[model samples]
Target chain A: MLSLEYLQECYGFNHSKWKINGEILDTEKGVKRLTNWTEEKRVRWHVQWRDQLAEKTGCLTNRMIQTIHGERIILSDAGWVTLHDEVTSLFSYKNRENEIGAFFGRYFSLGMQDVDTEINDPYANNKLKIYLQQSFLTKNSTEEMRFLEGIRRESRLRYNKAKEIKEKAGGKQEPIVAPIRSLDQGKVVYGQFYWTNLKGRPEKGYGSLRNVLTEWLQRYGQTSLFSLLNEIDKEFSLKGYHGKNLLAECLTPWEFLEYVMKTRDVHEKDELLVWKEKLTYQWEASRLLVKALGEWLDVAQEKVTV
Target chain B: MTYEQPSSLAFSIKESVWLREGEEIDELLSLALEPDISIREADDQVFIRGSLLLFGEYKPKEQDSNSNSYSDQISFRSVEEVTMSDDGIGMIRHSFPLDVTIPREKINRLEDLYVTVDAFDYELPGKGCIELEANVSVSGIKHERTEEPEDTYDEQQDEESDDYYTRPQEYNDFSSEREEMNERSFHFEAVREAAADDETKDEYESRVEEIKGESKEFQNYERNAAFEQHYEEEDQYEQEENNEEPVSYNTDPEIEPEYEGETEPEPEPEPAPEPELVRSEPTVNFSPQPSPVSAVEETHELEEEGEEEAGRDQTEKSSSSKDENALYLTKMLTKGDQEEFSKLRMCIVQDGESLETIAERYNIQVSNLIRMNRLNEERVAEGQILYIPVKQTPTSKS
Candidate 1:
């Protein structure tokens, strides 16, 4: 957090006399009578500072200013300050009533622009300092874009997590209770109960592994790890299926590891190690995918989580 | 019944005939009056008797050659009749005997008892003459009678006497002496009699003496209770009076205070003993006296008791008589004092103290202080002071 005292210290200035348009000007009177200062007087002061700073630097594009905190350097063109692209995008200059004067004063006080820009000199060096300040330091547009990008990336990760889970389960067989005999083929074959039942088979079943496993998981997942793994295997047919057949394919990496622990008579330590390795590999792969996608999408990488 | 004079008149005059020129003659007549016009019904009719004078004018026919010779042919006839009828209206009919013979010369001559006709020669075809007859007849009528009112003074006097006798005579003496003596004694006797029987007077007196001692002891025990109750009651009365007074006073601020706290109980006991003393001593003095004197003495005792009770009541009321006045004066004084004090405090604070410090010292909110002084909170400077109200601990949150 920026403390009020620090901001005050950084911006504080002492009243002083200076020469403007070949005339001595009192800083106190200038500040006090700022409302009464004519446009001519302001322009005259601007030109005086422009010539004095330009004579010392011998370059108009880049100039240094003295501020309360330290010396700041900026780019300018002629005497007009230039803003950075990010900063310019954050705050529009079109509708600003006092854009030039406010930008000059702000940059001048902060010492982030050349003194030639503060004097309103039309020089390339002064323009360079204005451009840099407007594009980079003056407005915090990049931070805002990063914040929005983080939100978008987080939503994408959630979407992908759900999508991955969906794809892993896409080719699994629903379940079959009895063999289906096709009238044209004269043979019995394992098929989903819904298809057999629709074909008017006599032994159509009312319950399936998916329904039972989902019910069991919903009831016992929080209390027992063994039941949770059992339900997962039964629902996915992970223990019974392997290879690339569409009706009964092997479980995806995460699901297969879960299946091995449920079906094999393994010690608890072995199952944990298996689960830990699979999870670590899945996490690493997910992180790399997220990082590459995030960059391509111009989004933040903080979105992807397990 | 009251009678008012008739303020309206109704009358009509009808001629007996349309007279022809030659048949005109002098007529002697007696009028026939309708029946039922008698003295008993006299109020129904009005009578005006007088002679009617007839004046005649003659004009000769234009077709006649003697029109210039009849210049002096005009004549006058006068007749008199006594008129009596209801509301000045009368109807008369004359009957002539058919067998009576009369000479033509006599008919042509103007007679006092013959009918006469007057005619006019005119261009119109209708009859231009009407006949008049004179006959002798006696006529009379009965009229409505006016009644005389009966006397009721004797009956009213008798009723007044009876009404006077219905009321009790003793109230006079009761009221007369009631004002002369003390009312406290009278009420005390009444209350004492109502409380204790006559045969038990001696017993009651002794019992009362015992109770007096007991009461004094009980009073010591109940002193705090009675005092608390009295104080609480007084406080409640004061608050209610405070509310009633201002509302009433605001409407009519100059109303007297004695009317406000008239029922308060301060001087009641002083007159209490007076009735007791009067009740005990008066009957003793009247025991050997005559009946009238004893009656007088009894009445005197009653009056004395009444006066004593009244005096005690008045004395009791006298103390609180000033209470309302005092309260009113105090209320006025306090209001004025508060306003003046607030003004002075505002001046003092405005001279140099900060509003926040003043608000803190007075235990009021800074916002309230600013509002009271009508100052802007953000722009207020040091030593730009404001009014600090004397804060009261709130009794309840609204």
Candidate 2:
């Protein structure tokens, strides 16, 4: 909803100089895009991070653009406005997983020291246990109910194991600025993946590689995931803190917890059946992810001896 | 594949190809899944014969053109290197052979041959032409025949040649060899003799100090003279070469000539005439360059320059060279700023013109052209109203 005059005055554009296509401005200088994010600090961090990322790797990111006023974010009637170059070329980690993996691997090696945010504990929420205690006092004889007992037992054991791993990590658990869904192909343009919406998580330690792996599972599945890991391993040497932290995250039973939370408020008997299928499906998917991660760990362990 | 010996001949082949006219390349997906290679030996030289199957997507210049996609099996009977460039809109394919000499020991033991296209690079240097370079390697395996049992062969050879080790009666004849050894001084006697004839330590040290002092004085004199000469020359040069505009110190050769028009040329009052849509053979300028390290600090400073006076000051300093232009686009591309060195100009697609050529002209990507136009495919016809992303100021045609 930015006025044309505002763009002309602030950006030094001649009146009716640039063509507007939705959120993108096709100017003689280059393609400029309007971004939804407005926070100054986060926007600045993104600028710095992407700048450094491009400096380190040949790959470029769609970072925020500065206005003619020497400002990255300008206050306008439609909230704080930020612009970025909209790269629409199709470049994904599909066949080029190694390159994508190498990108993240180099990112991990960059070390996210300046990223300021609270340490997110992946195991901080105990809502699953609370939900199970309240909703499952009696066996409802549903298909989902039959698996709940086993799931609860397994989740408890896995949760404790993760806790133990974190305890071992202790003071060494350094938070990293991790992309929420970096593996998503929709964000990639011209071989540059959008490394935006970064969050700090100490649970996965530096690079937040565990978070990336989980995101990879959700988007790309396990196929060629090892190749991606191998590429990352080549760049960042995902041993010690990165390796152990990722393993710990892999052990977390988020699938079960997510299922419990999804059906937590539902009291109707009929609605439970639909949720049952999803729970079982998520449980199996989570297991496959865990198994794949375990195998990668085993191979990595063998490599240590070699 | 069987070989008589365990040796192989390796061939390194380099080839370059141009994209067909009217078609612009978007991205090279990959080389073909398998390579078809054959090897022949004649006149003590090995010949590698094969075709490289290149898989990629190409955008035709004309909408509704049949050749929307590009996949080619480029055959070659080539020497070590082959380079070809032609002017037209038709697909041009050529091949060369690489002659590999087999070592004498393994010449006759050739068995199996393998070829792989290991490296590739492409450049869209204006025009709808994509210059592709592929580095292919062909190697032949040497087959080794099974040998007779080592012990038996050794025993048989020993029996055949009874003079394996002769116990000579002249074993104690060290006198002949001893004389030569005794004459040669293999120790540090020469060092002792040189040291004996050297100057005294005090004299040497004082001489060293004198030399050092003299050198220092000479260096100081040279430095002062050079500085004075440089300033005097600069004063004279400034007086002689003074113009209305300030001098730019930017010396990047790749960028210097590009912006020569920027500062020198007057803006044309009239819009440029639309270019004819004639199929011009893409000039095969195959120079692959690595992106140089940008002056990021200087760029950040430039970004903070919003005022007109500051802008003039910057223009005086660098005049917005291609590096700066690249940095400018890079900044925009990297989500940095809406700064402008050039403005977008509307361009009409000439005949045999592809998005690649248009992008090259603008120094942008073909994909960007597709995105900016929101075209379903990277196809454009003559007189198509496509926006050139960044029209270079004082525009120079390549």
Candidate 3:
């Protein structure tokens, strides 16, 4: 799936045009809209806010160290230490009762081994394929296996949606070194949920995934994503699936792979396969965040009041 | 030279996501579908990479208000042979196979698919399937070359070539031509002086000898008188001026000789007979410039230049102001260069006024207005703005 990050940054709703049509969903307080802003003013605010969001989240990658000419480096040593530590700690658990739990735990650990050439660690592009032949991917047998499959199936759908958003924004996902099946999040699930300020919370006012991301960035400014990525070294961002051209400005997921390989100090292809689970979890986590934010703040249209 | 060109493919592909046989759709966590296509030329093959981007909130039959959607991507890769243009300019097309379906059989794929515009996502409230449209285009693009290559310009060769002109020649030719023109007046003066009275050689010699003898006697007498006065006044002036500082000598005192030249004793030499004018065809240019050969002759020969100039002056003096204007215009045209001292004046057409009439009133050529304003009609309507050249008649040069 693609990252809707660029679109989120570029597009914005005309919130200044929003009128208070009905009472706020949770309270009797009527929806308040400050519509004194002109289109230019609103757009300016959105662009600036998006920039702030990108600064906090989009600036860092596990590939290489980026220089800002300011005091802040793109990725810091402290951030890398945190990310490596967190991934190894959180992703190294044994599978629990959940059918796909073991698979998730084994793949997500940041301490991945060097992959050999002869082994299979599918190159990570945005596109992910599921090999149902793997017992963990298909829902069969017990109810637990079925639950794992359902989560994966949903994750896959979300991943594609994110991918579409990425492509629409005139970009592609970075090459990742993992299995297609690993992209599904049945293995590791981070239970963090947030609410959006959109008109229809549970129903259809949810704007496009891109719209949601943009709203999220507009509201929170990537602070959550920053925390999610767990920071990395600036030097770490310099390495990725991208060719020698080092643009630290572009934060790609392949930077995760680079971080994994380097920190683990492994080059074996099979070792890369173990990462599918963790990378998949990461992708799912980001998608959920984007979706959550998209729903809460999608103010593009007028919806029926509760 | 392989230059990248961007071409867009406008195609529509449609697919549907069918809910299970007896399930009502409700709320989706996320709903998204994006169409994507990529171009890759590798390993002696050109392939198109296509994928479907699907994610978020899926409510198939509206059974529940807060249901979640599946998130994943469907991808395909293939290549179809496309005809390339000879000049390599048009039609570098590559098509790849694409297939998409929901994993849970919540959506059923359509058979005999003839759908285009495959990018759309919406709920099928009572319906079993979520129909999606996929329509995306591919465009070929070439990266811009950053640095501009230097042009292969050769100045020396351009100078030696006949089809070119250089700036240094303009400077040199302009100065020398101006000097040559100035010499024409000098030559005219010489010619005018030569055309004076004639006398025999014997008479001229006798007259010169007589004047020389008289001049010698007059000079000797004047010098002897001056020398005596200087000696006598030296002692008196030395003490009187020595104390006051040496008196500066008055240099080159003017002497006025009486006008006795009414009848000169020295006979003047005879003027040369006027040369017969040779008649030659004048080379005319399609434009107003005079032929180079005739121009050169006019500048070099004083008599010819004088004759031509005299005729021109007489014609100018006799002409009326109107005719003078015409002459001035002709001269201006022949010069082929004029500065725009005034702007191109705009005029509005009045009712019942035609282009020809307007031009006549302004004393300007109708064709000029047409060419300047790029008009196709010979007539203009009232209040229509027309841009005409300024009709500023040049004042006569002093």
How should the candidates be ordered by TM-score, best one leading?
2, 3, 1
Q: Write the per-residue lDDT of candidate 3 for residues B164-213, one digit (tens) a residue.
A: 22212112212212111111100000001111113212332342343223
Q: List TM-scores of chain B, every candidate.
A: 0.14, 0.24, 0.20
- What fnat does each of the candidate structures reach? 0.00, 0.00, 0.02
Q: Return the TM-score for each candidate structure.
A: 0.12, 0.38, 0.16
Candidate 1 off by > 4 Å = A1-207, A214-306, B1-368, B371-374, B377-390, B394-398
What's the true lDDT of residue A263 in model 2?
Answer: 72
- Among these predicted structures, which one has the highest TM-score? 2
Off by over 4 Å in 2: A14-31, A77-79, A115-121, A124-135, A139-150, A169-171, A185-208, A214-223, A267-281, B1-398
Query: lDDT per residue, candidate 3, A164-199, as tens digits?
Result: 443434433332112222111112224321111111
DockQ scores for all predicted structures? 0.00, 0.00, 0.01
- Ranking of all predicted structures according to lDDT, beginning with the best and ending with the worst: 2, 3, 1
Per-residue lDDT for A223-273 in model 1, tens only? 232333323333232322211111111111223223333433544666655
Residues B319-381, candidate 1, lDDT per residue (tens digit)? Answer: 444221111111110110011110101212221236565555545566654544445443343
Docking class of 3: incorrect
Residue A124 miss distance in model 3 (angstroms): 3.4
